[model samples]
Target: MNDSPGWASPGPAPSDGRPPENSGGSGPAGGAPESTPSGAKWSKEQPPAGQWSAPGTSGQRSHAQTPRPQGWNGAPQGGGWGAPGPGGWGGPPPAAKPGVIPLRPLGLGDILDGSVSTARAHWRTVLGVTVVVAVLVQIADIVLQRFVLPAPMEITADPESNPTEALRQSLESMQDSMISLVPSLLISTVGTLFTTALLTIVVSRSVLGRSVSLGDAWREAKPRLPHLLGLTLLLSVGAMAILTVAALPGLLLGSVGGALLSAFGVLAASVLVIWLWVRFSLASPALMLERQSIGQSLRRSAKLVQGSWWRVFGIQLVTALLTFLVSMIIVMLFSTIALFTDGSGMGELLTGNSPEFGWAFLVISSIGAVIAACITYPISAGVSVLLYIDQRIRREALDLDLARAAGLPGYGTEQPADHTPGS
Candidate 1:
């Protein structure tokens, strides 16, 4: 199977044994002609900060340092400093710093940087995809909240009524709230699937050090939509079933074992659900990138996640926390400003006790939701794809393949059988 689906294709072998340029890809800056002075060789290694090195000279480094490259700012440049060819001045490859990520076995920092870099490097494509999805989802949510759902009913504690009646009323109210949330949940679910599919392709292309347009990403993702949707549904059903089974002990034994059994069951289910979620999180990337069936992708995720569960979990946790933090900051800022400007009862709105739904409130909150989604989606999707790539690198020596795919010259040999973690 090809390592990169939709992006990597085999062709006539290069005459000089150099790795062929990426199929359907332009050089670093979206297909610009990349060249260097002929006869000069560039190093395969990146020099330390503030230092440059002449190629083919071990331990011979230059003291001269150029300012950080332009692409570092996340701006799209036509071409960056190109590597010198044979007998030309040896320098960094033109695609060396294409986008945000370097093609290699990634560290945590690399994953994080790659995530942010992708958004910055291809802001137009990445943001465009996310903004359109988010705005549509938000519009759907706003419509559901403002028009379809019945107006919120104020429920007060009925001290004069029987306790049993009051409990029943509270339960009914809770059920109503849950029912009203269903449309929003469905909207979010669909939005996540579409965005993840598209962005996964974008992130994958970035890993290959190639730039892709929104159209390219959508075209690559479209055929996989059904598979991606099925995979998501499978996971969702599986999680719900596991939790239900876990809760069965509590439900059946409720009176016999009291609340202790219920508490234990809930706790155990939560732990198992989290573990499984983290473990299978890479399944989506595998399904989309490897073009595997649902079963194959789940098994592939398990295989890759087997020994690296904690590492993957930790990285995912950090990404979630970071995403949440940024989102929280953005939402809070917007909400605070809106609360002051609109003067719609902040207390009631925040506490979810408002008896009335204000159009202004819905619009403001939806705007925040849209902004947060736009920022968080790429980071979340980028981390997953990068994690999948990292695992392949660790277990399958995928870095060599990625290097060659990115058109790095020296790594064109077949991946070694004796793959070491640090290799």
Candidate 2:
């Protein structure tokens, strides 16, 4: 693509998800690598595992949308390559479409569109699975909230006019909430993570055009449990560490300096954490699809993610923002009264408490969560998987495999014969 890296030939193992001979992620524009990714990859036989690149790029996002090899010319077409017109030798034919660049690299629209399309294509399955997961997760939340909490009677506080007294009351309230939430939070976190992992696998398979069942998804994720747990621990520990460090540095400062310095420190820490998050975002897919180790997955992700960090982040942001807006619209329709809080911000009442719309609040809150979950979960999962593809496209020339999978013409492989070492 553009001036990005040149594509590396695959090594010995041909991954079911990608052509193995293409360690670079992109095959030579003229020919597919002889390395099939179907078996275990010999990491040593691969490139130095340093930086990766792709080759044979062309056509900037032209003013008018280019015709997709299939119809609907306006839809984002995967980049194309063709018979080398006397310029170089032949290999994996670049995307078949004429006048297209092999390295069109993904854009924001490309990613989100893929996400929505994946969702829409499997909306029934996604919605059904999301609802099931949300119900289970929410049921767990309620059980934790109602039964497992320390009795609200554990401590008492006196309402008072004094500011210090009121502050104490607030802290006590927050503390109680947190204390009661501990067990449930832990459970919910685990449940949510598995849900995230499963959803991620589904989205990945959906994008990859493989048939997947809920059972299949769970089976896929089962082996990766420890790595996923390790990732969670890393993030939680890192966050706490940063907050602790930030707080320590500011304890000596007065409120004003402390606030300023702590905010700066926290902000810096956040940026670093965000970068790490993005780098590891593709780890799960790498782990499952490629059967990589935790360390190997992390490094593979980092290698692919080197130059396109901002683009990946932008894709996530746009998806989250879009889903948030949808959630807000639901809130406005069903929880208008809850949004009707008093000037003090504590005077609002739900219809469950009021004769008017009490049921509306309960319904809105429950239904809203499900609706939001359905929309948000799939999109988030889709975007993450799409990010994996986007990285490969930029670094390894994944677009070629994608074109083949989509069955667009000109890729032209006929089962085993076409399966020759790099095809």
Candidate 3:
């Protein structure tokens, strides 16, 4: 709220029965156009006074938080509009208290708080789902690392070894290591799909302040499992295809020129994928919450994400970084413990001096991964789901439906009578 781009604390509504204004003119404070992404918005014809500015004034004050109306004594009233004032304006009549988010358009803080509040409110169900998935993933990864992965082939000193043969041997070793990782990758991917689907459902219910048990969430999610899997596969395949295309420059041009071009192509490809990933990131939530097919979900994400690329990207990037930091901390803690207890030669194992990891190192690291996943999954999934909701509230006026669903009164109509095209 303190001059941050998108947040404004609610202030008291103006007393003159006029929409709040920026120094320049009417409209949300910022000088952004009407279709500006998310910073400010125009109210319908009957937009509550002080709540919305007229369309088109390049509202410089757009970043200012519209204050909820106040009571006679000047205390902030209940509900977004607060108690109706002298001219039938003032508060939006009384409504049920919002559970996780207010029944109004949200700011960045609201979105972030909503995610944490959802987890706190439904800790048992959310944590329970994450724990189960993380445990399964950890178990699979441990088994793959301990038993399924092949031991590296030892190479004796070849007094007359050919340079080409040595190169071939190195490539083969790399291929073997990659092969050993496939099972772990597959397990992690499957777990991610399952957790994302289930947590999305839980998060949606939390938005409506509805009670959902693990059984209810599971039942709701079960029907969409196949489609969710298909969706994940579709996205995975698309990403790989994009990466492969990017790598082509490097591949087709074998010389130094080709290598340089390939490197450039890869950098460009990485940027593209990150952009595409942010744009399509909402697909999982769309699919699970809307019961859409894989293709429909992708289209839905693209549509909702249109014109809001940077905002979505920023939120996602922050969430990802936060989760990664937490995961790293956990892994480091376990690694340190293992080091003191039994991590004698992990460096050698990593460098291929040893054929496989010792059990203590493997178990400790695996446990760290599981714990990190358990903590981070809910936060990540919660933020994604909330972002989806925020978009809907902004573009589709979903707040009304959500309010009604939460049993709030005085929001029965999508738009107030005065909120007409010609008004």
Candidate 4:
């Protein structure tokens, strides 16, 4: 069974993973990249004020010998002359010191930066396939709308015409029709495969520098399907069970009692459901890519997310808001134009009855998908993969892998050599 569903068909993939460690090299402005080791720079042992060297001169002088790097003017290239300002009166901006890890926090900007870098590296795979997949799926939608739905409508409308009843009946028929088809089941099964593997492969290849083909993603995903399916069924049953518990009053008592309690039950169930969702959101990556079993992966996800729940939730919330607002704005703009512009009308036009339905909505959505994938897929993958990396860093001291990948300068098996930007 080919695991390559619509997502990974010989195209660009979004990048994701832990950021590689920097070699402690400085850029022109003296800023170190995120990948640099925290202990990058070297600081010297301080001497007494009386033994301080004069600015631009090497000999030990007086109690306030050097005027500091700033006031001294044109201090030489080597690392000797700088000092505390007058009477140790605070320094000259601390001589442009390098940053320390104690000062590091996982800011929104850092995750967003990781996301952006991931995309830059793997966007081609993402774009090439999303457009094609979306087009094919939507064309199937179009064909269904154009040819298939009309006959059922005609049969129900002709004055034997219980028009409203016929419409309702047709809808019921369609609903029954949808759930039982073999092809649909196959599509759904394949879709599951796509969701689990393609994204991970793209991400791993992009961030971890692994070379993965569509074939590779599929084969890797195959053995995991049973486990994934079990997880899915488990979640579905769990959700229904919770909802059923919530609806117990309605189920056994009078309608009034059930109605009164239903809302609260739903609220409680929803909270639990959301908690579970976040807890397991990264589990697919763990199971599919990391080769962990269902129970183990869930535990791993929870552990990785232990201190970062709010941050992860916030990141997802932002992604949702952006996806919703942007997709809506574009769709509505096309819809408004269709409503007002000559020949751009929809509705009856969709039944081939006033004007054009502005098919660009399809294309616009496709573009939105690509942009969304570019922005989000990588972030999602990167965060999960980076969490994996962070675990390794903590356990195996794998910051060395990150440094090597990033091509950082001056890192080794032994202690890292301290560096000063100029020195």
Q: Give the top-scoring candidate (TM-score).
A: 3
Name model 4 segments beyond 4 Å from true. 1-106, 136-196, 208-233, 251-257, 334-380, 387-398, 404-423
Q: Candidate 2 overall Cα lDDT vs. reference?
A: 0.57
Ranking by lDDT: 1, 3, 2, 4
Q: Which regions of candidate 3 deviate over 4 angstroms?
A: 1-97, 152-176, 252-257, 343-352, 413-423
lDDT of 1 by residue, 117-212 (tens): 989878899999999999999998887777788865656778887755665577568767877887788889999999999999999888766788
Cα lDDT tens digits, model 2, 222-305, are 777787787677767777787668666764563556656767887887888788887777776666556566787777777666
Q: What is the lDDT of candidate 1?
A: 0.71
The lDDT, on a scale of 0 to 1, for candidate 3 is 0.67
Against the true structure, what is every candidate's RMSD? 11.6, 10.4, 10.7, 13.2
Worst 10 residues of 1 by lDDT: 62-71
Each candidate: what lDDT?
Answer: 0.71, 0.57, 0.67, 0.47
Q: Which portions of model 1 miss their true places by more than 4 Å?
A: 1-99, 152-155, 158-173, 248-260, 344-355, 413-423
Model 4: per-residue Cα lDDT over 76-179, one tens digit each: 22343334457643322222111111011234555455445555655565444344444454455555544554432232335564645555565467645654
TM-score of every candidate: 0.71, 0.65, 0.72, 0.53
TM-score head-to-head 2 vs 3, winner: 3
124 Cα displacement, candidate 1 (Å): 0.4
Candidate 3: residue 96 lDDT (0-100): 29
Error of 1 at 387 (Å): 0.7
* lDDT tens digits by residue: candidate 3, 244-346: 7987867675555665676788888889888889889988887777777788778778877888899999888888898899999998999777755554565
